[model samples]
Target: MQYNYNISRITLNDDSHQLIGEILFPTINNDIVLLEHVFINPTFEQQGFGSLLVAEFVKHAIHQKLTVKLLDPFAKLEFAKHPEYQQLLINE
Candidate 1:
């Protein structure tokens, strides 16, 4: 199955045709983004949509050179799994 994996500075959506999940990373400062929430439709949970959202968000953060001040537990877990994304964290 192919998920849309949409990405933007403030949001990540799971699909181009449907909204299966989302990640909210709002800017907190010139160089920081606060990862406020990650919401995957309950029906879509545990199917990797959330992880794709985080991965795309992290990539965008890296590309934009914005550090992530993680508030979302879901994002924290995803971020913890990848070493490449460590430098993108604000407090790590």
Candidate 2:
């Protein structure tokens, strides 16, 4: 089975200003941002594009004083394996 939902995409570019990768997120409530899909094109995968996308999202969230909830597969794993992530989950 598959589930579909709307995502707002944000893209970043290179020095030449060419688009490289995109991050997709869903807005929840009026004060939360739920990151749903994050992809760094195969060609840009290991170059921190994913982190950059996350950082951008964080910046927006901070500006709006919104809580950020990343509901991706790795978020669960990180929650399970990292104390910091677990604390974040608990704090929210």
Candidate 3:
């Protein structure tokens, strides 16, 4: 089955709007937004940019009163193993 969604490219402020990350949202249902893919240049990693992007998207979700869903490959198993992520999964 094909799901309907929208993809938005996040850009930088410099001369060129270099692609930083992307935000995906279901077109049929706006109540939930998926954080599909988020990646920063290796050189730029660990500088809070990923968090900044997520924070901005979360802010948007808050303003829109929408639920945010994220799929983390690494965190999946770890989440299942941990209490915090397990709680988060249950909440979701």
Winning model by lDDT: 1
Runs in model 2 deviating more than 4 A are 1-7, 74-92
Residue 70, candidate 3: C-alpha displacement in angstroms: 2.1
- By TM-score, the best candidate is 1
Identify the runs in model 3 with alpha carbons over 4 angstroms from their true place.
1-9, 12-16, 23-28, 73-92
What is the TM-score (0 to 1) of candidate 2?
0.64
Preferred candidate (TM-score higher): 1 or 3: 1
Full-model lDDT, candidate 2: 0.58
Query: For residues 1-92, what per-residue lDDT tens digits would candidate 2 score against the true structure?
Result: 11122245577777666567666766776765676777666877777666666656555555556565777774454345545333223146
What tens digits encode model 1's per-residue C-alpha lDDT throughout 3-67? 34333333334445456777777677787879889888787888887888888787777777888
**Cα deviation in Å at residue 86, candidate 1?**
0.4
RMSD of 2: 7.5
TM-score for each model: 0.80, 0.64, 0.53
